[model samples]
Target: MKKYTLLLVLFFALTNAFAQVKTQYFDENWKPVIQEDMVYYRPEPKAVNGKYLFKDYYKSGKLQFEGFSLSKTEEKFDGEVKYFAENGKISGTSEFRNGVLDGSVKTYFEDGRLRQDATVKNGEEESAVLYTYKGTDINGSLSLYDLMTFFDHDERVKQIIYDGDPKGIRQESYLSEGKAKYYGPDGKLLGELIFDLYGNPNNGTMIEFDFNPMKVSATRVFVDGKEQQLEKI
Candidate 1:
């Protein structure tokens, strides 16, 4: 009689454990989506309390990206994200806060050299130090949110620094001093220009240089606070 009682108790315990495991498997909301070798989870009820996993795959059956979102619903990303190259190597990694980039982001070259290490705040570029694949500093201590402006679409410039005190509501007048500098991709100073306190290049000297081998190429100076081209004798 005691043996029968013990057997009955063990059977009930196993039955309860199996029921709990089945309950945790997934509700009707989660549907497995398989595209080629990629798999993803899509919540049926757009809003539900749970953690969701996301993934992408390369055509060769390798993982391209993997990340997760934590919330009461599967809305926005709020955790770590990773990316991979076609060769299945990690290419980049970043953290996200509510779907916006909020922390450190690092990228690497195909050869595994660190390409960039930068920070972002509220989805805007805050500060950065650029480098070459060979691990050389192309530009150091770059503060994009503080004092910098790009005229040409390309931003390989070091000149035209904006000195301003952005303290209050009037941001336009905060630009105290303005100066422009130009540099070559080889990291040599090429030219310089001056601008008004308000960042206008109306009455300023512009210097040009020849950096194939560093030297001064030409000079243009503004006179009478007006536009005039100087003719060489």
Candidate 2:
């Protein structure tokens, strides 16, 4: 990458400030990598006071992301991480508290207009995200379940993916009848779903909550399998 050469020139200039800035390489999956297979790289030159830098760049030399990873493995991202577009504009930023997103996650348009402003607390969306859906502000425009499905949050629904899987590991409820109760990782009640014999949601309410205060965020009502409306609380 042409940017690799430019980094070399800059690297030598700052050699004195860095105790040892090893350029760690990673593949698309962020696994430990060699230069030949790298899609991202970061030279955590040094830590000041107590914070270490976690800056990643694309092979093209354009900035990719600047953030704080809890460890060199880059697994537990615990702070605000700003992602950049190819043209170097900040595309988005996410706030994480020890790996779980717990605050504002925002994205922007290329012209620098706010695209989506959603708040997440302890990994759950609360309230409606203000966004221009097809060029109009869709604030309070969709129900919680609608917004969840819109952002693909249903993928997190628990399912019976394996035999004898632990309660914390199930993906989606496979109960073919009656009601099913879902619990959060903290063992708190999350929601309930009433499935018909055909394994479709027949009647019930799906809920979202703010974890810290342990309060209901928004609710979606379903009657005879037809969705009702969103109730923001």
Candidate 3:
């Protein structure tokens, strides 16, 4: 009798799980669309809650991009979004936090060589490098976001420095006095900061990019007429 009851419960659980999912299709604008008009589509909606898996396709019906969204027709995206070429090679991947691109994002060559590698936070591309298909490194940070076949945000670069454990440094106006102290590789000095006559926080003088999403908090070390804030994010 207990075994029979268990089987009944299991059946209902699986049925409900399947029912929760609903398939959706849409046009380029993400409006409610018919099967023939859809440029984008969703998984049969089941088991998805706050985030829904969504995909856009090329006219050839090859997946052009895929990501998670808050709803069927809206792209308030969260988590990692991926792009692909018609040939199905992954062209790029961008990590999004509440619809804003954040963390380590990269693009690749068809042959799978690294094409672009970047670190971003709060919709800002703090540092990035672009590589030619032939492997020449080019500055593809900030001003170049639009040229890429992805999303766009206006980034004004102050400076870019190569850094580690997957981190890069940038300088800003507020750090005119203070310095950036980096402790890593088991707490050794990776400090690259400036000491103002009064001391404060950064730009070309300091900052890092991480998809590892290191603990970052902006705490004010000093407050003056300008009230410059220090961000250790």
* Steric clash count of candidate 1: 4
* Models sorted by lDDT, best on top: 2, 3, 1
TM-score, every prediction: 0.41, 0.45, 0.42
Model 3 C-alpha lDDT per residue in residues 1-233, reported as the tens digit of each score = 99999999999999998757456677878687877887766655222676777777765778888888776555778899999988999999999988788898999988876778888989877777654331233575333211111222343323222223223332222232244554333444444555556544323223343422333233333333243555664
Number of colliding residue pairs in each model: 4, 6, 14
Error of 3 at 77 (Å): 0.9
What TM-score does structure 3 among the candidates reach? Answer: 0.42
Candidate 1 per-residue C-alpha lDDT over 12-129 given as tens digits, one digit per residue, 9 for 90 to 100: 9999886441111222333433443223222222222555566655545576667766642343677778888888789998889988888877888787766566677878766553
Best by lDDT: 2
TM for candidate 1 is: 0.41
TM-score: which is higher, 1 or 3?
3
Best by TM-score: 2
Worst ten in a row by lDDT for model 2: 143-152
